[model samples]
Target: MPCRPSFSSGFDGTSDQDAAMEAADPRGSESDGTWEELRLLKPREVRHLIWEQVPLVDASSSQEYLRHHLPGALHLPHGARLQQLRNVLPDLSQPLILYSNAQNRAAALARRLSNLDYANVYVLGGGIGILLALQDA
Candidate 1:
C-alpha cells in the first residue's frame, strides 16, 4: 500500500455555528466576554509563516520541546501558561500559531487563546506529528 497522509480538522465534529457558539460567553473565545476567530493551518503553512511571523508556539512539555520543535518556535509549556504568556509576548495581535506533540492540544490551546482576545490564533493541523511524518516521508 502506498503511504497516505491523514488529517483532522479542529472543527470536524461541530458546525460553524457550533464553533461560533463555543466562542460565545466563556466557552472558548471570550476573554472580554466576547468572541474571536480560530484559524486552522497546515504544517506546511506554519513552516512558511514562521519566517515572517515569528509567532510559532509549541505547547508541549519541556522535554518534548527540548527533543524537537519547529525552527523559531517559542515554548509556552501548555494551555495554563497562556496568562503568563500574555505578559511574555509583546504583541497579542501578532499572528500566533500553536502546536503540540499529538492529539489536539494545539486546537485546545488555540481556542483558549482566542478566548483571551487574541485576534489571530491559529492551530496547526495534526500538530507536530504530521510534520514529523511528512518530514520522514
Candidate 2:
C-alpha cells in the first residue's frame, strides 16, 4: 500500500507547514470598511502569471491550504490585519493574486488589500479548484 501523508495541526518541519506559518496572520483580512469591484483573472491567465513570480496568496482555511496550494503560494488566513500583510508584502505597487476554495474569502482579501492601497490586487475567478483542475488537465 502507498504511504499516506500524516496530518498535523502543529508545524512538523514540512515545506507546506513552513509556508503556512511564514504567511500566517491570525487576525485575517477583516472588513477594511470599503468595497471595490474586484479584478478577476481566469485560471489560465493566473497559471501563466505565476511564471512571472507574482505572489499568489491563498486565502483558504489552513486545513485546505495544507491539503494543496499553488507552488510558492502564501497562506493568508481570514481576519489578518493589513499591517501584517504589509510585513509579508512590503511593496504596495506589486501585483498580488489571491485565491480560496470559495470565491468569497478571496474576494474579501482582495477588497481589503485594495482598500489598503495595493495598486494591483486581483482575485482568482472560480477559486483554486478551477486552477487545480486546469493543472490536472
Candidate 3:
C-alpha cells in the first residue's frame, strides 16, 4: 500500500494560497470600512474633485509615484518633509488628499499633516488600488 500524505502537508486550512483566496474574496470587503474609512472615491469622483482644484498628495515613495499616480497628484513622502510641503502649500485650509499603497502610511501622514495645523486634510481610504479599480471599471 502507498502511504498517504499527512493533512498538514495538504490544505491544513491555512496556507498562502488560502490567504490569497481570502484576500481576493469580496466577502471581507464589506466588513472592514477600509473602503469608506478613508473616504475612498471612484476615479470619476476623483476627477471631479480634481476639476474643483482639490489638492491631491501622493504619500508613496518617489519611485512608486513615478510609475503611476493621479493626474495632478503631488508627491510628498511622509515625515522629514513637512517643511518642504509648507513651502509649496502655504495655505493650510486648502483641501488635501493623502494616499499611499497602504492606509497605515496614509493615515500616519494625515495625522502628521493635521498636527502641523493643516486643515481639511483627508486620506484616500483605499489608496491607489481603489482608484485604479474605479478607472478600470
Backbone clash count, each prediction separately: 2, 7, 1
Candidate 1 lDDT, tens digit per residue, 1-137?
32223324342333333333223323253476322344666655665565455477888888998998776677887646676778878577888888888625676777787777787887765557666654454
Model 3, 100-123: lDDT tens per residue? 775457677877887888888776
List the candidate 3 regions with Cα displacement exceeding 4 Å: 1-45
CA lDDT of 36 in candidate 3?
40
lDDT of each: 0.63, 0.70, 0.62
The better candidate by TM-score, 1 or 2, is: 2
Q: Candidate 1 at 20: error in angstroms?
A: 26
> Which residue window of length 10 is worst by lDDT in model 3?
2-11
Which residue pairs show collisions in model 1?
29-115, 30-115
Off by over 4 Å in 1: 1-37
Q: After superposition, how far is residue 38 of candidate 3 from its true place, in Å?
A: 7.2
Candidate with more favorable, higher lDDT: 1 or 2: 2
Candidate 1: global Cα-lDDT?
A: 0.63
Worst 10-residue stretch by lDDT in candidate 2? 2-11
Candidate 1 Cα deviation (angstroms), residue 71: 2.9
Residue-level lDDT of model 2, residues 69-135, one tens digit each, is 7767778979866687799899999999999986679988987887789989988766776666543
Model 2's TM-score against the true structure:
0.72
Clashing residue pairs found in predicted model 2: 27-79, 27-80, 28-78, 28-79, 28-80, 29-79, 29-80
